[model samples]
Target: MDNVRIFELAKKLNITSQKLISLLEEMGISVRSHMSSLDSKVAEEICRKVKPKAQEKATIPRSQEKAQSRTSEVTLAETGRKKPVQVSPGISLKEFADLIKKPPSTLIKILLGYGEMLAINAPLSEEMLALLAEELGLEVEVKTVEESLLEEGEGGTPELLESRPPVVTVMGHVDHGKTTLLDAIRHTDVVKTEAGGITQHIGAYQISYRDRKITFIDTPGHEAFTSMRARGAMVTDIAVIVVAADDGVKPQTVEAINHARAANVPMLVAINKIDLPNANPEKVRKELSELGLVPEEWGGETIFVEISAKNKTNLDDLLEMILLVADMQELKANPHTRGNGVVIESRLDKGRGPVATVLIKKGTLKTGDIIVAGDVHGRARALFNDRGKRVKQATPSQPVAVVGLSAVPSAGEEFLVVDEEKTAHQITAERIARQRARIAGPVRRLTLDDL
Candidate 1:
């Protein structure tokens, strides 16, 4: 057997490197650090000793478990406090401890036991604050800052969250009718407007179905747009896999499925060109079923709809299934909070300094708001909808083209509105500095662990 480093061995054995090192020192093994290596015989002997101790750690005594049950079983609601203390997110550890009237060291100890090693000044997420509060037998409310919400004209985290429209992505092989399907859904000839029927830039749009809305991302079928397609998958709540009935399943069709699955989003199949005499919907379904996407009609969970985008047939069924799946997810957002979302696509135009197509995931983005997108920040000079009409504001699940970014942000980067332009500038400056440092940093050599 080959020798292994202390840390790697500890990881394989499901124990901490420090604990293993301590055990080695107790056994007079004299391992220097977590990086120190041991021969096979010494490693086997160490494992023999460590396994029994690991079992002891794994099997807690009934007394301690019973004691833990009484505290762990009690949730915040069970505390029954008339007025709960509200904790704002992203507060520093020291600040949080001060607010809770607990010592910073005590909170640090709790976090350490919970497998976190944070500095006293390190920012704490709302979840961390809640965990600390629970450990102290206290009930605390976690929410976005009320002042920021009020400034943006949004109530702080609404008590009853409003349902947001589901963001859907249409993906498939090139010339397999993805564009035609989108045109049928939008009832607009977008390809006709573009030069040579090829879009200069594709982003996203919205369409109403049965009084409800669905956001559709215009992802082209070029290999160059694979990253953009992956980004679309990440933000999309549902992915519509458009497979040509005549062509069945192609390599790109499988690639699209991989991207959606990688993002862990739900998928629906659109069997396009079904009106063609050569169309084989069954063959398409069989190929897809082999890839783990069996249709619901065939006793699988994946939804499938045969549609002729040219004739605009069965499009209603597709939208209905999207809404049905979205309802099952209970998709919602707190529109009462400051607006924030992901950039769909961005570019610097000759006429317009910098413009970005963004999909709003939560809250509302309004005109004149100071927005920060990655390393760039600016005030929203204008907002345009999918139809190119100027809009005063965009609500949750709405995709709109935005104007007035300091620089074109990369697609998939998150954008959020700040209360002040000064804050936006400060944030962008910090992010820019960090990015530069990363770029300027020396190249790191690969390690065995990296493999």
Candidate 2:
């Protein structure tokens, strides 16, 4: 058959052109007007959906009946879980359900359970992709990081995109063993009582495990994590929420889960305090599953690791899960380009002047690079790693303390490297001006008498 016009299809289906167009739009099939054309495939799909009565009344050949029944029975459910399904963001629910070989009705029902009144024709967001898959007991892989690599070219080709360490954020309640867990991983005493050690200071540290690296952002809680997101920086790849097995899930724990979900970062749960006699890992799993973070052991995708930070038990297992998730994400960056990153933290030091801890998301940051962060522009006079050791250069996913910003930058500010100091100044100046304009509002004109 030939490509069908919107009006023709609408007439054939006994529906108005506008209604048919709305349906097409819901499917994300960009037909604009009554005269818009639909390809043969789309026309067939429309006919199948709108003319269901005709299809039901139509007779099928005896030879093809068995084949049709077999095709209907064969789906992802029958095939069993093979490999994770790779999905691109912004696909319609119908498209996604078809990709997973599941019925669109199932997806719609799942969405309704989550209070999302979306239809099968609605386009699913990236977060929805992960959520719907989890509920259906399927795995979905969204091509976000690699698509970003291609977009953030930074004057380099795809060849420059290489594997980078995953930036993992740990968030939870105050007394749920977050500090102790971090201390165990880094082998350093985190001052739980002082903000200078963890709360006030937003820092990121990397640990080498089994010849691979994992970077952890030590933020106070979900607040700091979301603050960075609000600044338009997606610095975190995976979020590991620390939950106490003995205490079960607390109010703050729920907040952390919601924050992680809102950020749309993949989550792994660390069931801490398992060393306690009263610890109940199963209870913790049940509570988290109710919050939509079902553990893999329970037939869901979320990884749950029961550990005791005090004894440093099962720490390797948690780190291994993090690496496994990171590997699946396929994190990469173009380290050869100019530095691009976000400010993890910044403060004015009496001796060193304005010091900013920046996590380089892509490219190599050097000591002599002219950089602009938010509204501040300066030369990177020096660079120091998480260990306070002086470093000449930093690569992708490497967090470094930079010296030479004229003013302390806010955490989560976008940090960039430019060709010259003047360009940096120009960019920062423009940003500052724009901020001022927003604050000042539109200029008020004089009244008619004054004019």
Candidate 3:
């Protein structure tokens, strides 16, 4: 009995290993860690004093408990009233036990009865545990992750919103000339600059047309670059899908449509190579209309333009249509606040250390500003525009290459500009810790029969 581990004793008392360690130390017990063995007499004494207190703590309303502690149930004795247990989506088994005021061992027994074995801290979806809670005579109210984010975003006032440039993503099939269309608009040979004539990275650039500016994100059109295309759609205000006039719609074309639709961004189809002798703009329109992109000329909402990238015809009309749809959407973001944006791409450079292409979604990003992106943090050492010119700051809807990240962040990761280096480092540390916990923690119990 002297070989009893401290964690096993904590389990029996329904408390965390850390809490049990503190209690043992208060009793003059010299345990060094959760894995330390405790004498039978000392373990019994500790359990006798800790079990009732743990039960009482478990019944306390989560609102009044320590924020560091797991959320638990509302007690009838404490308030002379009953309240439905608050459960977040994907609640863990240990949290479920606390919310229902049941011992983890009891929950394990119930799971075994249903032919399922799960780790005590394994997460379970609300849908999988709803019936179980009802059978146990406990009411559960679930709150989803999306609802929380929406609530936070809705708290912003209308006064902070200002008109911003439309961010457009060019997407289509490989060799469908998405880059060539952008090249024709910018009056630069981008396709010729890429290695092997294939764009391997996401590029962000701003183009001025008719005294108005539009930010264009050129995403790789290959099927293997699906993730890059999805990220492009996420940060953009609109999608410009280039379809070869003679080739009609293809597999990657369908995927681009789906990505734009999922991001809820309006799409304008660009029928390229219309100058070719075999070009068929009408056929391309009809095929895309079948995929829910009915052309406005056909009495539908979608705007379609036929252009020749090589000949650069109707390119101005394409730019005008992009502004028309952007004006209708009334896209805006405040430029006076702290900077926030999404990482377009990142890599380690021999001369630059860590460099990233970031698209500024809101406010202004400047040199010396401490930036944090996912698990990375650093002060902006330098900012360069798309044209390779050094810039002091970038405003909303502008993309700049920033050089000074501690590590290259994943594409599509949201970055925020904090006031102090300490805050940036703290945020990076906290996020890194959370990610590690999620990876090292118990495996999620996905179903009733999961073992």
Candidate 4:
């Protein structure tokens, strides 16, 4: 008799491959992949374990099944006591089920009863998990930490550790002079690039302030895209909130503040348009205080600076504050290892085919390196710094526009440095195949008879 793979057996049993894999692992089968071949005798044993013989199935009574479920539920309600299972934030339902010593399928059925149809890998908030645990007669404890979906970069030796530039994100309401401030700093007219003076795209730029480099990420307002603004806050080391002195705080300004706070980054308040006659710096300060931003001048923690992009007043002070904050944070990264970072933006160019703006969080990205961003993989044929200068290498905390990806990756996707081109292609192919399999996985379709 020929051998069969685990997935084939799962299909025959009308179950998912993932469930089969988990079962095999629990059984100490030493299986690595669902494609791993099983011995003929072992496959038969597995089939018997998953499903009983036809005679047994016919003999089992429906009343017995209901009684068994009721008994299990009653046992769970009476057995457990005060032990709380510790779980990370946004833990998947399957993982939570395992933590609670229950089968994932049981939890899935419970969720279905609650009208929440979720994937096996879908995450549940702590509150939701607590409710589920309560029903299961279990207790759960949540662990909090600064979270990042990006993969950890390669480690570095002491000699390779160096201070990197600070990645700053500018966010605020519309007409807050965000792009204009960046234009003044970079000494270029990027405000003209946007239609109607509203920045439509995320722009990363680098500038030298008093001999030190700072990379600025100019994020679009929520009117353009809320996701873009959220991405900006997540990736940045510092957030410079540009509140118009004349306008104080607007609706979008509060949105920006919330985004920054959620990212848990240090914030600096920039009182822009201070040169205007109607500009009230004191009124802006009072409004920010109400929002929990007590200025340093007022004996609070936040650092605030008054500036005018048009008149070029106190621009240096803002830059100095950014550098000071970066120094206090003590940002350092490894330059000798492979690069890993988030994709700030991606677009197709008529001339260049596909291009992406990548901000390196750790390690160094060089030309000719194989990179994988999401399911897309390609060689780094070229790299240009934020200033559009063609560069041979990019270090940590630097934003570079890359050319030669197989496809334009989605904004905010984390890219990893792969060892070889063939390996990169293989990994990307596996990822794509997994995505396709998930899409084609078993789903309960709606039927007219059910309706």
TM-score of each: 0.64, 0.64, 0.64, 0.63
> What tens-digit string does per-residue lDDT give for candidate 1 at 128-165?
87788789887777654433333443332234367789
CA-lDDT, candidates in order: 0.78, 0.80, 0.78, 0.78
List the candidate 4 regions with Cα displacement exceeding 4 Å: 1-159, 222-233, 433-451
Clashes of each: 0, 0, 0, 0
In candidate 2, where is summed lDDT lowest over 10 consecutive residues? 52-61
Clashing pairs in 3: none
CA lDDT for candidate 3: 0.78
Work out how many backbone clashes candidate 4 has: 0
lDDT of 1 at 95: 81
Q: Please provide, for model 4 over 1-451, each residue's C-alpha lDDT reduced to its tens digit, 9 standing for 90 to 100.
A: 4799665676677655666777888888887544467899887877888863231112223345446557766786688645467676667988787777788888888878888887889999766786788778766777531112122233323444667899898989998999999999988889988999998889888888878899998887633234544445245889999999999999989998887887788999999999899999999999999999998667677888999998889999899778767765767776555688888889999999789999888777899988988688888999998778999988888899999999998887778787777657656675676679889998889999999
TM-score of 3: 0.64
Q: Model 2: per-residue lDDT, tens digit, 330-359?
A: 687766666888998899999999999999
Q: RMSD in Å for candidate 1, one decimal?
A: 20.1
Off by over 4 Å in 2: 1-156, 192-198, 442-451
